[model samples]
Target: MQTLLKPSFTRETAFLKVKAAEDAWNRRSAILNQTLNTKMVRV
Candidate 1:
């Protein structure tokens, strides 16, 4: 993760990496929210 901020990496590379990571986390968050909602409805 720190590699994304290292000076050795190009700006485009870092930007793309950050964007990809953000997208992945967003997807995970959505899934977690769905699971929590389902559990709450069951209760």
Candidate 2:
């Protein structure tokens, strides 16, 4: 049950949204890097 952050969010919600986005981005980047490294090693 997470709170939905909308355009009209308070300071705390804004920070939460930013942190969530950053964490997601970091996870994606890590997965992409690992995939690339595996392909490079196989080649």
Model 1 vs. true fold: TM:
0.62
* Winning model by lDDT: 2
Assess the local accuracy of residue 29 in candidate 1 as a C-alpha lDDT between 0 and 100.
97
lDDT of each: 0.82, 0.85
lDDT of 2 by residue, 5-37 (tens): 767788999999999999999999988778533
Q: Lowest-scoring 10 consecutive residues by lDDT in candidate 2?
A: 34-43
TM-score of structure candidate 2: 0.61
Residue pairs with clashing backbones, model 1: none
Stretches > 4 Å off in candidate 1? 1-6, 36-43
Question: What's the CA RMSD for each of the models?
Answer: 8.4, 9.0
**Least accurate stretch of 10 residues (summed lDDT) in model 1?**
34-43
